[model samples]
Target: MSTASRIAIVTGGSRGIGRAVASRLAAAGQDVAVVYASNDKEADAAVGEIEAAGARGIALQADVADEAAVTAAFDTVERRLGPVDVVINAAGVMALQPTRELDLAELDRQLRTNVRGTFVMAKEAARRIRPGGAIVAFSTSITRLRFPTFGAYAATKGAVEALVPILAKELGGRDVTVNAVAPGPTATELFFDGKTQQDIDRIAAMNPMNRLGTPQDIAEVVAFLAGPGRWVNGQVVFANGGAA
Candidate 1:
């Protein structure tokens, strides 16, 4: 997965899959801007890893759902790293509860980061990404699994999936790619927050590999899309190890 050096901006790059994506991209010779909502210490450490991989790295703070903040983050990336070639909206939130008892406030929170965040990032990427650039958004395989308690979270990613192809077509002449990576039961803080050991084991066994996905596993798919997988545009890639 070799690619010419390019500039990439990864939201939520301070941790989990986004952090892996940032390090992976940098290792592949891309200058990376790690956009995190907060947690400057973790963000700085992520940049340290990127720089350790021999690529220029910086950390920026912004609320993904805030249009002005997103715009400013992009401006900073452009000023510090040059025009962005890859924009990955991996900033997301999850709240798992049955629809009957779902928390409306939690739903709102998920909507803000997952749906609105992607919306803002996609709009910015469409406007600012260079020719031949790529935009990647996070989705979840829970939509296909139809699991209980994932209603609100899946709904937001569903919105992400819906938005991707439409944006791809809207950017038809620009040579930029817009796609979503829908991961299944990944082993991240976001995924493990509520699950018990038994819950995790059962879910892991459902997949053929009998395991949960690693953030790095998802990052590999994203790295491909961000780098040389230009032909695979406007699709939701299910990187779930056949869980669904």
Candidate 2:
């Protein structure tokens, strides 16, 4: 299929890495559906940006973990924009808490949004995305960093990493590609929240690039996977400036 007519769904597309990915895909000539859990204004703004990029765009709202909601979102995308050619599972939550003092409720919340959310979206994409499509899921480099307060967050992402290869195998006969993009320390709200500037600087220095990754950096990788990088399948691409 040609890029101009292709369709893509980006979960959590209202802000951060998801928004960047959605915009990048649209600019690459794909009609885009910008999905968000809340914040209709942000979602709408993202769609506007997509349209301004000369591609069709729409905004849909659904909690990533809600299977029914996500299914409906995909249905809406098909009805309005055509069959999905790419699905980016970028909806997730992150909280830093030491394992010993981790709150059970927090853990459950993270699992529901990160782990279960990826599963639900991937399942839906597997069913609906056309052949030659791609499914890009988000993961974190923290899984390898073994950061002190990142145990819970890293665990959820590890589950996501585990799912990528298995899902690729499950879709063996299909031309679709399944992969995960594991970004190291991107300068997104999720990464900035509850972090001191000192902490951020220290982490930035750890990367050979001596800077935190921008949303655009990660978006470029997603654009590649969603469009021309068909040869790359069933693997995790780390966009972390060689931090790992």
Candidate 3:
């Protein structure tokens, strides 16, 4: 089917990489549903931008970890837009601390949002996504870097990565593709939080490109997978500028 007839739901679409992905899909002529957890205004603004791009857009609020909320969000998309053709699980949190010093509550929160939330969305998508649809889950290059204080966060993403191939296999003859995108150090608020200028520069210098990845850069990869990159499935594509 043409992109103009497709529908996409992007979790965490209010800001950051998720917003970029939603915008890119809209630009590609797909209807987009921008799913946010708490920010109504930002979600509305995102929908405005999508509409400005000349595509149908709607903002739905749902915590990614909440299965009922996610199901309702999908139902809204199907009713207003169409049956979902793409689902991008981009809503997540990062709490960086040494594993030895990390609070169990923090660990639980990360797992809930990153792992359980991804599973919930993936499960829903598996059931509802149209044939020839695609599911993109987010991971992190930190899983490869094995960086300190990233233990818990990486663990959650690692679980997401593990789900990709297995889910693709389960989908079997459905012709739906499941994959993960592991971004390296990116210039997003989530990556910049609690980091010093020195730390930022150091990370930016780690890649051969000598710069952090942009949300658009990562979004382009997603757009490819969602549209024409069907043969590439059940794999983790690192959009990290050779940082890993």
Candidate 4:
């Protein structure tokens, strides 16, 4: 990698794991453009953290599932930050319901953002990412754990995992890597949303680390995949701290 600062696009970057990844990339001297769904305040705060890390930062709002909006966001990044060197497709949504009683509307929402949004991001990345660049998408440890009530969420990510290697092979000889990070029970607002303290503790104890994964914990993996972890490509990394 050149000493010339690279640019990174982190979706869902207004909060949670995405925000942490943006900050980490910035600290490593990469300018980061955070693509958030909504919440102007949070997005601005995320940019502040990135800029405070001594890297350039910008916040752009877009619905990840909308192709036109996503495309426009990509154009804006290029116009302001230069060609994209890294894209972290971290935007996603989840609704916990038994597969038997699937909430059709919620399922659609998850599919739109998780599966379709990932595909959209991947498509843009495949077209725009510079050589030696990387495209990192988000998956969930629940996919491996077979958790109940995670059926729709896991389905979307399963598609993402399947897409990883196919896209990598398609981008053959491009010096770009396509990979995903399946994070375990991270301590994010999204994860803590419906669980009780006991539920959280039980899930945490399932892993050898004996605690919930943090946003920073997963951000480290994204930084590696998006930076110098070149030999690793077209694979889904279990960043779950020995969970499952």
Q: For candidate 2, give the lDDT.
A: 0.93
Per-residue accuracy of model 4 over 1-244 as CA lDDT, tens digit each = 5424899999999999999999999988999999999899999999999999999999999998888999999999999999999999999999899999998999999999999999999988899999989999999989999999999999999999999999999999999999999999999999999899999999999989899999999999999999989999999999999988
Q: lDDT of candidate 1?
A: 0.93
For candidate 2, the per-residue lDDT at 57 reads 93
Note the Cα lDDT for every prediction shown. 0.93, 0.93, 0.93, 0.94
lDDT score of residue 144 within candidate 1: 99
Look at candidate 3 and tell me the lDDT of residue 137.
97
TM-score of each: 0.98, 0.98, 0.98, 0.98
* C-alpha RMSD of candidate 3: 0.9
Counted clashes in each candidate structure: 0, 0, 0, 0
Better of 1 and 4 by lDDT: 4
lDDT of 1 by residue, 188-241 (tens): 998889778999999999899999999999999999999999899999999999
Model 4 gets an lDDT of 0.94
- What TM-score does structure 3 among the candidates reach? 0.98
